[model samples]
Target: MSTVVNQTTPHRSGSVAVIGRPNVGKSTLTNALVGAKISIVSNRPQTTRHRLLGIATFAAGKDAPAGQIALVDTPGLHRQQGKFSASAMSKVMNRAARGALEGVDAAMLVIEAGRWDDEDTLAYNVLSDAGIPVLLIVNKIDRLRDKSALLPFLAQVSQGRTFAGVHPVSALKRNGLDALVKELLMLLPEAPPMFGEDEITDRSERFLAGELVREQLMRQLGAELPYATTVEIERFAEDTSLKQGELLRIGAVIWVERESQKAIVIGKGGARLKEIGSKSRLQMERLFGRKVFLETWVRVREGWSDDETALKAFGYE
Candidate 1:
């Protein structure tokens, strides 16, 4: 006798937390899957301090149901010790990452292709212990010179883990992403769509503006100021007057932990600050699809990264 299988369900929707070590391309993968830049990306480690949600909706095809995958981009999991200034910030970020992992139907543990470190092990242990279906996403595959080396690396990483699937993808180049999404959709639980199909991310424009500014600062300043910089949107106003080209006015403050850092950000003759503002404003205009008038101010917050209360006020909590 032949057995019959039911195919009645036509939708799948659930949350999948993207956890990984610092600079492993978790944010890049999140943006690629969502088809929008929801999370900021930088070469610096621990750049993502918040639990950012990027929602990706997949249309129903002849073989499968429609699905919505809520991708939670989280801070990198790492070992921090001592009473260093960054310890408090590290703890807060780790807490946020842990919270994002809890109650999720699935998890995507992103790691750099052809490499694994202690931090990666730490992240893997956390995800495996969560008792949820884990998907191993080996990102940055395009950086590898020898394509044939990926399989052995994948097999080595999958030895004892209970991963539902393993996918090698280059998020920057959008390679192997469709197949990755297909597997992710299969892992999601059957349910109604959690968000509109057109929606890409859960972050507000105000938050995105701040992130854009911070991203420019990180890219421009390079190694000098990535860790010491933070951006706060002081005022974000939309003009409904239909007056000419400018549709939005944004005022932001770039907060540094010390006065010396402020000077560094402002640069010689305020030129660096101007460049940062110009780049950030252009990005904001593209993001909002309108003309933006942005003004940025640099100020010293004095140990804000280490101060618990200051961190909370800055939304890092």
Candidate 2:
């Protein structure tokens, strides 16, 4: 038997770094484009701490071109200094964001609808200086009650900078994504696909599991405690000893900077910790497609966010 492959027209393939300020829906847009939750989403700012690659493959059709875009979801670019910022972590995150844009073929600067502040300007300057085609992505338009305001907002943002293209999209609602993807495909260079068509992301299941746990922490704790929390997966392995269906065993540690923060995360009578564990386990099961035995522990690491050694141990380079 011989394997046959269909020969299509020249395929355009390259990477695009998704850059933006904190809480600008960059992760949501990356997940939307890839059709899966590669990057975790949360309402809190600075939710993304690492660079994640989400692969979006556009199939050849009568009205669409064939292409594969490796979308690099980066940490929010911000001018971090002064008394309020975690200086060490801020430097690490900014370094990661800049590194993600170093070799990408193009870039996308995501901004919230009807809002562009100093941080947005900072992000725009960084993306512009990368010397790559930067696409202006105006996200969260679904929040706007008046649709007429979108055009003027886009027009306002387009001034004083030359963007490769401008697109208005609601990532949560999956609106205007097709057009955005099409425009992105046009910007990618002609080359072979870097990843398999079936692959959606370059991150491992363990990394994604940790991110999901952190996401639950951010969502459950609301605006009060998430900034001080970070999840680290200590162990992830399959229990092959089981005779029945596969069971994944995951052990994670929720690191807090102080004992008081740990107590807050654990909550009264351990109810909050239990809730976070339950939600994280459910999400992990869905992502892994198997039974999961999740064990989570809360540990206090004093000033871990500001300590260089602790940051390195927590996988921040």
Candidate 3:
């Protein structure tokens, strides 16, 4: 008898744009699907200032096909208003969101379950206008008190909308994702994986270090100040002199628009800044799976958010 062998090729692979209003869990969903926290998460709106690619590859599971999803995670799409919405930073964010839709196979319009406000509609309009297949992902379903209301909420949002498929998922709990992946894969044509299976994101470790620091600023600072701040990785190097292991040496500058904000960030006797650095270093170690020595400084940039030249230098895109 002759020995028999078989091989399976990925049935689908393509880019997916995750677009929605701020604080709608788009980044959380992207992190969940990618099985990694490449995109930072914070409670504040517009926490994501840059467009990042999260690569999620699923092996041929019993209920899902073998494929790779190149998730295009962009900043939130919203109508410009309020302090954050009025500056060049907001324009850059919105522009990045819109620009991410170009040359994508599909778009995932993420929205909180049981809610569909004007901003949600704004995001929907943006995705629909992209002329690609839009899959409505009703996220945060686990927070609903009445599960029966889910059907009605889904019906309400689906009205007059041409979604290729609708899935009610709790990106936090990791529920209802398998089926969503199955449907998402079928919508794409057969193609090889866009990235290596082991790769989780397209961003470099240096860029991730800056974003991690920014995540801490967004979480630890006052409500208004976080929006005015951005993190810049001034130095990132590997130190291998120690016998323990390779250590990452990172220097980050927290750029605020004013002096008062800088004082506030430094906190009473430099406590707040220390806390931020400690938390950020731990997060970086966990994500990169290496020891990290992180040093941070709070500096004033004087209208950097509104200044295009300053924004570019600070790595805002």
Candidate 4:
């Protein structure tokens, strides 16, 4: 009698760096794939200042095998020249983007539909030098006025370049993502899941709490003012007094470079600061799945963004 040989399918798991220029919706795509708001999103450029991991695990499907994708969501690659971009903080952000690409099995080069410039080329060059498989993600196609123009745009970008796969997607509307996920998973190596299926991110709650507050700053503040500020979580602790669930008490300090900037963030009668805190608390509760009691203070840090030491203290690395 012939014995039947048992065969098992392999699981694909590896890291993929999300590479793009500023304001290209890299973080939005990262969160969409992870099924959680691990990275914050805003219209302002360089909103993502640090490297963060977003883990996405998928079940086996008709077209794709089971896999886990550890997304290294990076700071948008940008040139350092403008007053905002020339600061020490900007240099740190660029370094963080390059560093996050180390040891990744693949990369997703995200770009806005119908737009490509020097910064985008800079990002593509960095990824190409890594010698890893790249998937070109043409994001925000839904935002384009002429959807028919998408194909030509994709063709223009892919002309002299090599991509493992090309996908047009709307990260905000969740369009064309199922196929994108399958394409990305195939680029990874066959291995067991590196992270648990339930894990959406590798960042700690304290780190995420601070980031949520910073996200509010980027959204609510004036263009130049937001660049001058950063959020520091002074305290994060759980209060288990409630019967329904534990309450998270978080304290955040919005650090500004000047006293005038502090006044701007606080607004008249502290209304602006209150709005920031309220919105931030709501986002924290949504992400943490628990009640959050948050307190915010605007403090002057005297050019903290340009200070390397201050950047390290506030977790720039």
TM-score of each: 0.93, 0.95, 0.95, 0.95
RMSD of each: 4.3, 3.3, 3.5, 4.2
Over the stretch 247-301, how does candidate 4's per-residue lDDT look in tens digits? Answer: 9889999999898898999999999999999999999999899999999998998
Specify the poorest-scoring 10-residue window by lDDT in model 4. Answer: 1-10
Pairs of colliding residues, candidate 2: none
lDDT tens digits by residue: candidate 2, 1-317: 01123356567899999999999999999988888888988888888999889998877654456889999999888887664355788888888988998789999999999999999999888887889999899999999888898888888888888899898899999988888887788888888899999999988999899999999988987487756788899999888799555898999999998899888889999999999999999998887789999999999988788778988888876
Tell how far residue 161 is off in model 1, in angstroms. 2.1
lDDT of 3: 0.88
Candidate 2 lDDT? 0.87
The predicted structure with the larger lDDT, 3 or 4, is: 4
Q: On residues 1-317, what C-alpha lDDT tens digit does candidate 3 reach at each position? A: 01122145446899999999989899999999999899999989888889999998877765556788899999999898888688998999999999999999999999999889999999998887789999999999999899999999899889899999999999999998888888888777799887888999989999999999889889987485867888889899888677545799999999888899998899999999999999999999999999999999988878888988888888777
Sort by lDDT, top down from the best: 4, 3, 2, 1
CA lDDT of every candidate:
0.86, 0.87, 0.88, 0.90
Better of 2 and 3 by lDDT: 3
Model 2 Cα shift for residue 317 (angstroms): 2.6
- Candidate 4, backbone clash total: 0
Model 3 superposed RMSD (Cα):
3.5
- Position 20, candidate 2: lDDT: 93
